[model samples]
Target: MDNGIGNWPTIHRVRHPDRIALIDAANGAELTFGQLDARTNALADALARKGIAQGDRVALVTLNSPQMLEVVLAVAKLGGVAVPINCRLQAPEVQYILGDCGARIVFSSPQTAPVVAAAVEGTDVSEIIEIPSGEQRAAGEASQSPYETLIAAGSTERVEADVAADDLAMLMYTSGTTGFPKGAMLTHANHHWNAINNLTAVEGIGPLDISLAAAPLFHIGALGIFSLPLLYVGGTTVVLEAFTPDAWLDAVATHRVSVAFAVPAMWAAIDATPAMGTTDLSSLRYGLCGGAPCPVVLIESLTRRGIRFAEGFGLTETAPIACVLDIEDTVRFAGSVGKPALHVDMMVADPQGEEVSRGEIGELLVRGPNVFIGYWNKPDATAEALRGGWFYTGDLATCDDDGYYRIVDRKKDMIVSGGENVYASEVEQVMHRHPAVGEVAVIGIPDEKWGESVTAVVAVKPGADVAEAELITWTREQIAHFKSPRAVYFVDALPRTATGKILKRDLRKRWSADGSAVQR
Candidate 1:
């Protein structure tokens, strides 16, 4: 009976029993509110039977699916922390997260089963529940149970736990700009309030509205902002396993999806699709683009088709959304991320944390009920980031006289490549492992497809010769492919300061001055 996310399905089920709540676009599968409530309850009982009690960690490693949402809700119902892993991560990266969180159970799919199996080898993960992907399990692999089997064995009786509002709900991992990824601890209240803020910002979101889940559910932006908010208001959410322009357009047309959330890169691909002009997107009232800045031309093109493309800014530490540019202001303030959400307070401050003058670029600070508590198991990082009750987002932005904010640069050495955050330090670490590399500096350069592409400027050791493509391949083998440098540039020596610190600004200038970066 607490005001947690676990109660949302029950509330909606009682209010609108037969109303459609979710639609899996991949196979035209639908789950009504009544069915959703019953299934989540059953899954909660199943998790409890598996000894997943309160405060336990339950990790999910799968693509977008109705079962993914069900698992998250089930974990919440049992007062267990839900940790959704990025499906795109390599085995080692997944292993680090699984080990760090000490997950008791991991729900994986056929696609990610091999990676999960390899990751949980020495970890604390005791159960691996595989969600069916239309593939038969190998003869020898009977240790893992199918997702459907667990649900079938569970009872529909409501299984409840003593969950408090301030209890931890989600442990979201963010790829840090420096060092390994950290899990941001988001409480039940944090996610609940975020959904409230989202409902207030986007108009006409109710049971009648149909939303498209195009963004990856593992990301806070997709789950916290897009799916959770819609589910809270009893709206229908259409889940897409993965994003493809043609598939996205087809879903919007088939489901008559009213709203959606996607990155600017996705919008560009949709616009560039050959069937875009012929597709009927009139059902879409508006869509949100974040993770990177939206091109003015892309906004104008979508506007011409009666689809308003709004933009937002936030981080995983702030439950993903802090500010949003409304649909009406899409053209008026083409580049701004717009004003803060209803219950959120934002400020532009200097390095000393004092407020900056209007129109001056400074670090963006946000404070609200939606802001997460801190990073899991990182007290020092939590203290450094959450100072004076405000989350210091290491992003440089300027606010206009009218209070619209425009992001100018990232204070952190991070690159937004195709909607994924690639930390320069993480990429540099991989490059350093290469035997032929002596010194390496990674920086983000302006790119057309991705907002910014990861480029590595390397200085090979004496008597060591390494090809650009070979170095790129080497880096990809060590980390996530998306984090690997798309282009490599060899230099005699990298520009450095007297303190022996590489000046990344100089590298960016040098790379731009001479257009000689070897493209992948």
Candidate 2:
């Protein structure tokens, strides 16, 4: 009985080999527990034969597919670190991550092969594996060896590696808000306990429950909280390559998905879709909304339909789940993110790191086995973030006497647009590169659809002309499209403090006061 996550598939294979473990909704493919276990064992052997040793980093830049899941499990079995890249990232951003992580091998789908090729051109990545879709290529039209080929050629005999609970399992990259994205080193224990917390948070989940993975798999909220936990309990996971309202609703109705997790924006979009009303969603037992503050109205709407919504709070540094608004408390604590998860300790602290009184606003700090070990190769950042044995979440929150916690504001300048984290500094850096831009400040403004929309307030250079559309387009080309500003506001000068720091709160107020922010 291996104590690490690497053995989960093997355990389930022995217990329930005939159970369906995964269902690829896009292609209508299924993988039983026995099949998944055998495939992952073969893939692990193939990776070891390719010189991928324990503790080495392997990057996967592919969409939602069974192959992606296979790669994740295979890496775990090999005692290697899995770095799942956000498929929406631009080439430059992807290149930066690959270089930073020192990944020796990268697996990308044919759809994203061009971007992956460009990103790894100058990086340390030595081997590139192309995961082809089920469609077979014509004879003599073969390119690089397909993912299936590796699985077919390798042996199914389990490749055992010395793995422990404390060993590093994953390198989850945070959205680089200030500069480059930092990799949060999550151990096997961190992920194991996180799965336990997720299971405990939502009671009554059993082997018969089916979960939907509609959100991007790169995110911990989707993979860690939803998919992995369900797998631990021998439930089936239905995966979608990308989120679409029609596809999500259809999967739920078709697969009888009992549990699902999505960001607030996704929930909003699903509600707007005509299929949402027509589709039979009675099979869904509950759903989770997180990544940004979910609107109370959205929660109420979903709850009215008998789809219980559990809002949660956490970060990449905390294995992505520390608190969850259970279904029982959703109505009573309508606006809260709920109390700390099982075995997780949370506190509100002042600037001096002292715990604040109940009902007082302060930074939220968490301590638990699920907390990540530290940022990969970033000692200073790791030390600063994990001070006094607590992970500083950089979120301003208040805890009521009833123990419910509500987020007040963000201590860090981050924008949560459509459930994706866009660091104000990362967007501002690209905006400043425009020749006509003299100064730029990025802030998140309240949005109805997206929890918060990324808005850029800019001051044009003297005697230069630049349209808002052009600036937005320029920024999109530099980073992921989601991080690009959805609205642009022109200003004569930005308000700054005596120390020459731009007052973002004032900019947010100014934009809110007047209706000058132009949304595209």
Candidate 3:
């Protein structure tokens, strides 16, 4: 019943104080609700003293950790926007985001310093808070103590912010498949309602459940689906810096992770790990799979292992939780993404924005409180995306007679990274810039894990020879690291039709045949 720009910190503090809140499953560091709330308050005060006020955007460049969660909560408490930057992005790409979002403060690990430094070189960012690398002597000493220590040493004057339900809460950048990255403006209400709906839809996952945050915290799947919902119900979240088959299994077994969510790529890797077969996975009771299609084989494998796997579908614009398949639907619908959330309205639409009938593949359009406000500062694009009170998701999906939906393919060339969208055209443009490149097309190839890996096919100019490594290095310099092609192949001529259009479907078929091209 609570509305009006839900107070995130209040939600945690008032419900359960002594309950375990978050754990760095990698290092075994744990914090209760009261302790986590206190840490976030200190961070909020620090950001306020540094002049980050209401509506200002703050960039978080750390990996999965409790500190990452602290800054996100602090930003929300102060009515500022939290911009979760992809840590995999290189310097120039990171710079583009810093400038694009006009963030005032950036928190990054040593691994991201060079990239953060390059991005903030000409910007107005006042502070660059470093997360201890445990490698650099000076940085290590500086970050040795807890972040709460630094906050307590500073003044504690509370900075009150005037936040409205419509104000932006988070700015999630879409992977630039076609062009420059666009930051989707998700409101606090969008996230709050999405979490409530997801918690209800998932069944039996409430206040006492423990969830895994193994995916990149920068992704909505990790942040929204798992982390936010756990925080909402005053449950526990276990953070893992990165996923390894052994590490993920260890975390699940040791931590007793009851509700776990992972992208298909993570599942495939864990499934393939020899150690996975021997691990005790009985503690895992619920599994949520998204970021790409959940293969029937993977679902069956998890089910056989005593884990219930359900399919989910969403985009950054919907606060990323639009539809979920319940446990009953998982068996009935099988591969379907299930039904829309109770408060959400979903339907397929054509190019003209008219609703299409069942069994037809059209762009999925959603309308609800969970829908985002718009893209930051991009009025024309926002107008096009949100029309007639619906957020237009450029994803192709079909609904069966039973109201279950299944995503066929993205109408836009979007590639999901651990549950984040990466547009193909955006990366292809960067690859085409190379002097030796004559023509290029980027497509997603099937990976046993990662669901789809970014792959590029290039038609080099005659008499110009470019090695795979050279193209990889050149392209990585241009875009975010994840957006770069995982593998590159050069051909005398690209497969095309008689009219001269590149045949992407054929290209994907050829590339996925063996998966042994030059991988960057």
Candidate 4:
């Protein structure tokens, strides 16, 4: 197929016209591909009427719903950039994103109105379209709010924009290791290219196969690597609002879901669930596991269940897929992230930035067509990360002689605990807000159960006193539950380099040496 022939709207317009597109389990509503196209066209017309033009950024704060999918395609059709905000983000974090991206319109769920209102306050965004899910209608609509009224009113059909394949389609923010999140610019071609690569990796999907996409569509892993491929193959997608063991199993058996993608933590829950033991999972062939490393125990458990599970590694920069282990190679490359995808070049580089020898761990660098254009507005960060035409992924790994890559560590102090990413800087920021905290550094400690647990080393103000549990409790109240540090070390001072950067490696080493420690 021609690269220009892969624009989402064009692809949907031509192929799978009568096929099923979206189904809302919450409301028992379904939209066929033809109906989806019409609805998205109506939404595109609605967006254009609201002064949203090509290259405009529209922030979306909603859950995994049919409307979310519609708005995504609508944004592409209207030539606008869709910024899907993490629905769990707090007000301050949401504000930073809206202001940073210069979003003109924020379409959010009714539940998120308060935070969305605060985020876009005093901004250029004069409209907040609140989309109510199910049967609930949100209260406190301002006089200028035309979303509920207009969407209910007859939608005026408008001509779709001739969106070029190269037109920017989405702006996804990376889970920043330092400072605030940076927007990664991805074009329609990037989405199409990566989605195509993902499809080829799998043994083709058919209309008879149903895919359970429980992962949030906001993440590129779910959108680009999972959902879009299923759509391209004209397969059925069983969407879930959230991941629950019972819900997942029921969806699979109830919908006869044949394929799905899930993280390691979710698999563990499924294994432990009584429902999974009795429920029929024979419909599922296998799943693509990513976001975090899959443990040997979890892999064994899935294997025993006759499910073929594979691993892959990528960041938000590489359209979220640089390498994925082939299902055929799962036995030989059991713990490896496998080799790079076709049409991509991946290598391990040492500190000197030279390619490392086989079986040697080094920073992984990947060059591929799927890589993003650059960060939205941060030129320096973009240049540093994407130098010499290779995207320097801040992940450490080793490539075996068989060309399988195994991650040894992360170059940055980011922790993936329980499938939710916990950036050290974000946790440290919460610590800094405490009056008793003088300094702090957070690191990931290997855990047999949770994979990696968030551990924090804190230095209290000379005269003030703070307990470890107190700090943990404070952090829990401040941020999301999964992000809170499982343990906190009250120290006299934190290890720092000459230039005053906290040395997380030193802190990890110290904890290893001192066995007599409080286990918060």
Candidate 5:
């Protein structure tokens, strides 16, 4: 059996025992590669002792921390799958993921312990491991004691993983415009190839390189984009508990972060930060932007500051890296996701999966080892998404004359707010629960701060009236706040197509311009 990526820590430990593997930004605590390997071995043994063996599901729901990755690697070492839950999700949303994946153990932090507790109440979760947060212990909280005890009890002997290249390693949950979220099954080889693609796309990524894990690790953007790839390449990763413009700037300056990846919204925030001028960015050799269309202005702004900013595009199903723009071509081809990665094969194809002519809008399809294996336990979805060895990305794009690709539209009509994917249908499902809501269509309105703001265009029930604030608050109670509508507009009736389908495009067009919205 192939050792797979589970052996990364062990290999690096032998290769660079004294090298720093991780830096917890919360408190400047560092873990050497040797210590990291020993900890992962111990955690793996502890998990095996708890009845978690190969192919078992383990969940992690916590803020960004070095321990989060430690748990992921430990589970990987045991040939188990790690499910990282979005901390922003409410109990039901969290419960659905935990139950869907049938996770038996969960990792939580002091800040997110309550939500984790509520989410695992009726699930298969039998054990909860609280990761240290470097914060004062909350009332009734034993912050780092649980993990410390487990590590102490577990044997530190090396555990060779019994996994294959295509064995499922992670089940990443991503929602579509309709229905519940689907878990994308990523194999160990998929992640390794993605790391190679990133290393090849971004030149000079090696042991000397250090990256900041600023985005939430639950999202593939932060996990696969830079941090994991860096780890695969024996580089150091700095973990952040949360993202703030000040925190981001401080990480780069203090850690001498050589490479960083963040969404365009974050880049915009960094651009707007007053300390951008004073912060010592001399160590930042390269910056990558994705998760949304990057404005050329932002690229130019960063370039003007002497920071090379490149752009790329992909989805959770693609192991998150398919197309990439080299740092040299970032400003020249602004607004474009550059070309497909050196190892990835991409084509703009018609509905029939046939390639469309250049410059013609069509669905973007990608085929490569980096693509995910399938959706967890959903063969029908797996079949539909992966046909002819190409993952049909429901994104409208066109290949230009210069062989560049730009995303024209999100075919799923998904909303990306502040680097988070908010499915319209999931939010709409909650919004429809409101007694006053008759019909509603959720849309994303472009915002300078957040890449897009979730907006609701609703036609209330006849003779039933509700304040916008009331409806917004109602949705927040029922769903994650990030997915809730930032602005609610009242309409007499929702525009529809001949088939009675909601015309979301027209709603977007009507509200996207002039930012005109009705409060009631």
Candidate 6:
């Protein structure tokens, strides 16, 4: 009888319809549980009338807004797959996803309508509905709205679709450093359990916690980490239009944001913000970092300010919350992602799927209700990854004697030089120690003698500088000399995905095409 997450707001409305469910941080608009349920129902009916049926793909190309979440739930209500495209991606990139998914209907916001309009030109998208925005957005560009205009036109009755737990809910594409994006098919069950896993894994989150959605909502981290968990518990979510160091700090202080999640880069920006020291972060109970290896220094910095900062390891395939460092052990076990999350079965295993010895690095494997079903339309890839009912996360990690796990490096990101294996993350972690480094990504350059040479591409902080030789020597002192960067390249900024992950493949291709980009 349960219709998965589509009916969550409906259930919560019965308990506390007046409780605030969502907030638009940029415009100060709010939605209560009752309002959210009615709106999602109405939107679902509107979408159904537009011919969106079970198994149909509905693509959403927009920024973080309450309307975006509304669309997500509305599509789920119809048993339609919601495909979220990164708004930061260019037209061709957006076109690739739309063409690949063959989305029937496309949703766009004023800020991203131009890109969507250009991208959907040759796709199967029959209708492109634009959500209205304030006049301040997109440099005062005008936008036509038919989506919001139709929200009140449909009936509020629950439109039944027989939507099941096993039915596909979302087709979240993986934004990797290499290759084309692959859609990870997540079921309603995956989302339902991700929320349960989060509620059980993190100790303090409850009905009153207000989580800040700063990271790109298209990514699983910002959605599955806390936002949906809060939604499940009748809590509030304040959606940010876009992320900035000052905007994030101000939102936390103004909205009294209690729980949040960010990538290492965002955390560094917050640390760099001058107001970080003066900001009142008293309302925060805890925060989480993911998408990359979180530097231990960031954790220590926040904990010293009486804010609980924890790091975890997860992927888009796991509905993203596979494990987390407990609040009590955050400082004591600074580097490890800690034990597997509740409801998740984790192991470090060999290529044959056999469990490896503790302290030995191997592929981290996960199996849980939260894990995604498989990659959409890629049965071969799915079979390879989902062998034996366990998703083989290509992350190399080790389980310590105390049952904690630490990710060493991604399988594809590892570098081999002079027959020695080098993890870019390890080198990058030590590189982050430099006072002048703002962001950095380590890669391997082709080398005849060593097969590949370790290299670092760095972006120095504003008003800060570091010499190439000085940084190489600084890295050599902290780690093995061979693992240190043989070449250093400085740029104004490191290229990143919408989720704040440095695009190492793009960097590799850029330097390969232009030799002058390398300093050493």
Q: Residue 72 CA error for candidate 4 (Å)?
A: 0.8
RMSD of each: 10.6, 10.5, 11.0, 10.5, 10.7, 2.2
lDDT (Cα, tens digit) per residue for candidate 4, span 87-121: 76788888888888989989887677888988887
Q: Which pairs clash in model 1?
A: none
Rank by lDDT, descending?
Answer: 6, 5, 1, 2, 3, 4
C-alpha TM-scores of all predictions: 0.80, 0.80, 0.78, 0.77, 0.80, 0.96
Clashes of 4: 0
lDDT of 3 by residue, 1-520 (tens): 2222325545566676788889876557678887777777777888787788888899988767777887888788788889998887778888888988999889888787787887788876877887654233223353454453557765433345677767788999876544577999888888888888777776746878899988887877778886887787788899887678788899999999988878875786687678877998787878888765565656766677667777788877887888998876676676678899878899988898898888986888999998888898899999999999988887777788888887766675667765656666567656766878866878887677787788888988768999888898888998888889887888877764221235676777667776554443
Q: How far is candidate 3 from the true structure (C-alpha RMSD, Å)?
A: 11.0
Q: Which pairs, if any, clash in model 5?
A: none
lDDT of 2 at 361: 76
Tell me model 2's lDDT, rounded to 2 decimals. Answer: 0.83
Candidate 6 structure quality by residue, lDDT tens digits, 29-141: 78999999999999999999999998899998888888889899888888889998888888999999999999999988778989998998889999888876633333333
- Residue 379's lDDT within candidate 3 is 99
Once superposed on the true structure, which residue ranges of model 6 sit more than 4 Å away at CA?
134-144, 513-516
Off by over 4 Å in 5: 136-144, 175-178, 414-520
Kindly give the number of clashing pairs for every candidate: 0, 0, 5, 0, 0, 0
Question: CA lDDT, every prediction?
Answer: 0.83, 0.83, 0.77, 0.73, 0.84, 0.87
Question: Which candidate leads in lDDT?
Answer: 6
Candidate 2: regions farther than 4 A off:
134-145, 413-520
- Identify the superior model by TM-score, candidate 3 or candidate 6: 6
Score residue 384 of candidate 1 by CA lDDT: 94
